[model samples]
Target chain A: MPFQPGCRRLMLQIDILLSALANGLMTGAVYALIALGLTLVYGVLHVINFAHGATLTAAMFAVWAAHDGLGIDPYVAILILTPLFFALGYALQRFVIGPASHGSDSNILLVTLGLSIVIENALLAAFRSDTRSIDVPYGFSVIELGNLFLPLPKVIAFFASFLVAALLWGLMAHTDIGKAIRAVSREKTGAALSGIPVEHVYAVTFGLGAACLAVAACLLMPTFLVNPRVGNAFVLVAFTIVVLGGMGSVPGALIGGLIIGVVESLSGLYFGESLGQIGIFLIFILVLLVRPAGLFGARA
Target chain B: MTGSARLPILIAVIVLALLPLGATSNTLLNFMTFALIVALAAQGWNLLGGYGGQFSFGHAAFFGTGAYAMGLLQVRFGLNPWAAMPVAMLLGAAVGWAIGFLAFRARLRGAYFALVTLAFAEVFRILANAWAFTGAAAGLLVPLKLQAANMQFEDKRLFYWLVLAFVAGALVLTAELARSRFGARLVALRENEDAARALGVDTLRVKLAAITLSAGVTAAAGGLYAQKSLYLDAAIAYGPWISVDALLAPIVGGLGTVFGPLIGALALLGLGELSKMALGNLFGGAVPGIDLIVFGILLILAVAFAPRGLLGLFDRLIRRPRPAEGGEATP
Candidate 1:
């Protein structure tokens, strides 16, 4: 009977590990989606979009608003919000970011940082710091795969993110606009010389990045709470993933995201939540120290 | 260093020192003290961020370290505030040196460097929140004792004067550093790291020194802040808001200039207070995030119209009639 308790404890441990892994994968998929947006913008702009997280938070609020106001499904809100965010991104890049871009890198950094503060505070002013979340019909439904449990919302988010990633990959590989964006990213002057309209490409690329955030917000809203400062939590993780994935590499973002997710889950399980952040940050520093170019990044 | 410059700064300092004699309101004294403390920290930030061109997004780490050092020493070990401050500053310098070493050795540049610094602060924050020695988010409170040696004063005016001394020291140090050989090397490294390295500038050493000095000064300010507020917590000390205040001041005033942080701090703190009061009156209570909204707009406008800050704008205006002496026009 005493030995039986030991056996049960081992089984419980295994189950916990498996569950953490599963949960991490789901969360990592979303992280990859966010990091992909960041990496894409960095690839073209050569300026870190400090407001990337704020943009995601803004979109999440829009999704929440649509769901509450019109009874629109969170899934459908993605379609509406994506286009809206894309246009917003286009205008932002064209009018605001474009003008600021003329300055040094630090200038652009300040500009974006300022924009992030503006967006975050504006949201706070409007929303009154209340946490908001959308309820889906199948929000609480869970699927039992043997002893492991999979929440339906998380599974949907994971799959949706995966699908979008695949679609983005395909678009980048097989589309004319994608090629132009890549061209501009590779060589702005060269792209312009080739009559690629680099500025327009920059706007379009930024829009796509923002649209990716919209998709992520849609997937995330079913499970996570939305707030003005919600993006602050995710932004650093996204940065870690982007750096790990080799700033401009799509596949790298996915791998980095998954690694960070697993790290977060495992650390959270063993060392607690705050230490998990410390663990991730340590890994980030280690990666920067050992491999500044990143695992999949081309040498700068 | 120049007579004209020396005269104006001396007069300004004299005026600020004498103003409290006429207006002895606690509110004004408190505001001035806070602004001066911020100015001290901002000047520290300006050394590394503006002059060195190493934008640290996680300066909260050093600031927090200083506060925690002061808090921990005074609260836990019963160390005197006067002695604890220099120790806190040394701790800050050590932390800065360690961070700078790792980052520079890894050859992390630009945004990567910024991110690493941010991560350091975040890690420090998490640790501070989790550790019982830090009082675990409950925070450590300094015992209220009106002793000069304890660095606590019953009168807000005393605190104001104390902070003014530190701010003046920082301004002097910054002005001196701006003309030093080490400062030139830092600026050189900032402009072109590889070129500087090739020129035997010891770029890493220069950067490390700058960061260490910057961190030390920032920590000193943090110590004063802890003494002033008589409190130290993860959020209060290590939060992003602290770092934002440090960087924003120099950016709004004029990066790479000794007086920039002072001007920026006054403008920022002034505007913040004014807006807070106005918004409070309009809304019948303090609106939580209005200050940040105003700050963001101002930052955006500053970047757009005056990237060199108010000082740079003044320089441009003053030199407009004598275009020949304007030298290299700012981009």
Candidate 2:
């Protein structure tokens, strides 16, 4: 209990723990953003879009291409890419995805998986296997809090994540399109009977889902390298978070992502880096076993 | 459909079985041998994914378990591959039974089930890698032999023959299974689970049987692969690519069909090889991503256009010559 060398070590440990937790939270925000799109589409359409991560990858690539090939900043790329992504999602849902959704849930699963493979390989061919990253003007800058060190870009990314998630929540909760989307998410038949164009709602829902990636890709751009197969890791983690947060529960996804992120970071810091993945998976299994409905998900 | 249509298929199998006898090229023999093993693995997967309606993305765990079993036994105990192979099958079955119990007991279906299986395989890979006895990521290598029963061969023809025998055995067993009463229950469960359960079907038992048998077959293939390559490593034995191949073969060939797995393996393996040839060094030098790109595009086109797979398209072409029978062949 008295101040000693051991106590000093303990203090250092605490400092390390806090910093890891902060790092985890920032990464978790990005996870939630990516997962929110997947959960939304799944909640409405009852189909897990395996291609969701590929969409994120595509967005990252688009940003990289714009910045590197066409001389556009990442922030500017977001504005330009957002509309393109929305249109891409809208057209995809209406044409390719809509036809595949024939009341059988497996159809979409198969289609999306196929689409993911396509996107990954297409990007691989176009970009090669080399890793690419955006040169953020202030990428190396970090802020310190006592013994805790925080990277500025990560902090910015986290704040941007919060902003986007909040805007999405507001749009879903307060707007007319949001109401229709929510209704469609709950019950397509009922929503259709109520004179809402369910098809249009599906398109908009898909667009909104794709739009979530715009924010996530931008945030991820600073800290991580983007490659064709980069989506592989994100896809698995996003699914785990979605499952943890409760499938189709927006709030659950946000919270679930944060929990996983913190847990993963702490596990990496305390245990080993390899062990972190195991902890995340254990959490996944535990959540599935204890609460199939997820941490914040409403029971169907 | 009657069993009469199987005659042509039987003949096709017979021709494939004899293919290595006259083949002089070692490369051709190796390619054929690889294709046969892959085809066998795909058929093993077809039992669960196509017939049992349980899509597993972690069959590689069983394959790896079997491979490691053989490798470790031979390396540690100096046992013959002939002895080690049955042990591998048994070990593979046990692993299958354990994972199947954990997963199926929970009634995790669809994509959720698939992800759980993927997790299981990853766990297996991690554990295998950490354990020094299994040689970790560098992989486990079996001592080479020049005998038949030991499963070592100086001639590619002999390896081809062994692969052919195993593949044929798998196909016949799968066909026999389809005719079995349990297989009927499995089909019923696959078509309509609730209805099958209502009709006194023990869905769990049916699924377990399918899983165990599938795992055993996959393990046997793994054992053969260990002997053929004279090496077994985590990456090759328990790789994610194995799962991808397993899933892709059944889906791209024809789900629940007898010849589907074989056809899928041939087409995809050919495509894979072709992609590597075209994109392996296509740029100033060979680029790494072109094959994946080609593969992805092909898959998207396949899923979008021919979800039922190549067999479905073949059936359409064949049936077109005859009068339209209400277009029942259309997926």
- Backbone clashes in model 1, listed as residue pairs: none
Candidate 1 regions with alpha-carbon error over 4 angstroms: A1-4, B1-5, B321-331
Q: Score chain A of model 1 by TM-score against the reference chain A.
A: 0.97
TM-score of each: 0.97, 0.93
- Chain B of candidate 2 achieves a TM-score of 0.93
Q: In model 2, which residue pairs have backbone atoms overlapping below 3 Å?
A: A121-B292, A121-B293, B281-B286, B282-B286
Summing lDDT over every window of 10 consecutive residues in candidate 1 chain A, give the lowest-scoring window.
A100-109
Please give the range of 10 consecutive residues that has the lowest summed lDDT in model 1 chain B.
B321-330
- Fnat (0 to 1) per candidate: 0.67, 0.47
Report the C-alpha lDDT of model 1 over B1-331, residue by residue, as the tens digit.
2323555567767888998999978788888888898898999999999899999999999999999999999989999999999999999999999999999888888888888998899889988988999999798888899977678876778778888888878877887787778878988998888999999998888999999999999999999899989988898899998798899999899988888989999999899899989988998987878888888887888888887788888878887656453313655
Q: For candidate 1, what is the DockQ?
A: 0.70
The sequence of per-residue lDDT tens digits that candidate 2 reaches over residues B133-246 is 999777787776688867787777877877787887888787878888988999999988989999999998888888898898888878878888878777788887777777
lDDT of 1 by residue, A58-77 (tens): 99999899999999998988
Candidate of highest TM-score: 1
